[model samples]
Target: MATCQPAPTCAPVATCQPAPTSQAVCPQPCPIPAQFGCGPLPKITNLVCATDFDKAYIPAMYQHNMDIIAVASVGAEMAPSDDITDLAIKIRNERIQQNQKLALFARQAGYGALPVDYNEVAMYRNQLMGVAGMDFSARWATLMVGLLQQSQQSAQLAATRATLPQLRDQGNINARACANEIDALQRWLARNGLPVSATAVPGVCPPGAIAAPYGTGPSAPICQPTCQPTCQPAAQPTCPPGSQPAYPPAPVY
Candidate 1:
């Protein structure tokens, strides 16, 4: 009994397991990770950001971004630095060159003009810039494809409108032929004892006459008044030889 108690009391039982430590269940709010953010560096410099169209199109950079910048900036003294001014001029020149190219392409494609506006192009450019490794070539190719489809639809509509007159003429010819055939059939029916009164003709059917059967039956047949013969005197019987001669009356006007 004494040996068992001594073995049990040895070292107050030190366990091999480490003590429990509390850890945060979820991470605290932090800025977006570097991989998820735009540009190689997590933040963009004002000069580099100014190259972006969205930033350049803001009210602050409106004078730099717009073609009519000089006129608009007059008396409003918020002139950009020389570097920004040069960038704006370059952007404007590049846009003019692209527009000339687009116009040439439109002419070749038989399109009167491109349907998109400069604002749409700028928005598309901004989207491309937001995406890493995206460039203008791919975006413009997609836009041109869409424009071609729209032009084809417009051409089809024009062709349809052009043929509308021919279609109307064909309709009129068919309607006239139908009316002629209806009149001939009505004449034939009238001559074959299916006597149709003048009022019973097409569009002028008599009050109660509405496509009734051709033969006489429960439906009453319309009657026409018959012509009467003119009155004439019958030949007088010969008088007996001995009888007094019948007197002939003298005519007087």
Candidate 2:
């Protein structure tokens, strides 16, 4: 009757929720052509292609540096040191071995591999090498002509010097062409669903068909150099116990 008895004391009740499923998301394996051996062709995604293409610079620069050395050795007051040449040779051989591995991996990928771009990268590199060789020979000839007749020396040297820019321009063109090819290859890979780029479009979109936000810049160029991986030495494999080690030495060129 007096004031309400002490309010009934209540115990706290705990609530339990179901545990989350411990499922893992795995990418569907690539469809390996019958020729490639097992289950699925190794997934050669856009990223992988970019990586291999970037690795190409290894051989490209190797060839460039070797040509430079050869040219320098042609007519120098003192012969270029063997130490540097030997080092370059060693470095190039190692790079060549790596590129060979990459080529094998792609070939093994069989039909899953990205379409070949006419070996454009290699072609440009060869062109650059050829240009360098030609330049050296021309200069050597001019030098000989100069020594034979002092009067013709100045004119011959001048003529050769005038062509020097053209030679350099040709090399630049070749380098840029190679770089462009690398970009194209990445786009091809992305389109084929190798990496499945979010923004990559297989075919060209009609002009202004896809509108961009008010502030954003125009749609990205069909193919940009950004698509390609940086020009740096690729990560090398770890050496097994007691095996000779390989290091990514500095760029010779």
Best-performing candidate as measured by TM-score: 2
Residues 1-253, candidate 1: write the lDDT tens digits: 4453323322222223333443334322222212111111111122122233222112211211222222112202221233223433443453344345435544654545444334533432343343222223223222222222222222222233322343233224323432443344244334444432211111112221232223121112211112233444544444444544434443432
Tell me how far the alpha carbon of residue 163 in candidate 1 is from the true structure, in angstroms, after superposition: 33
RMSD of each: 53.7, 26.6
lDDT of 1: 0.29
Q: On a 0 to 1 TM-score scale, where does candidate 2 land against the true structure?
A: 0.21
lDDT of candidate 2 over 1-253, digit per residue (tens): 5785655544333333334444444443332222111100111122122234333322333333333233233433222334323433443453344334434544554413333333332332233243333343333322222111211211222223322343233334334433343344344444544431222111211222221122111112221112222344434444445544444443432
Q: Candidate 1, which segments miss by more than 4 Å at Cα?
A: 1-79, 118-253
lDDT of each: 0.29, 0.30
Model 1 clash count equals 0
Worst 10 residues of 2 by lDDT: 35-44
Model 1, residue 252: distance off in Å is 84
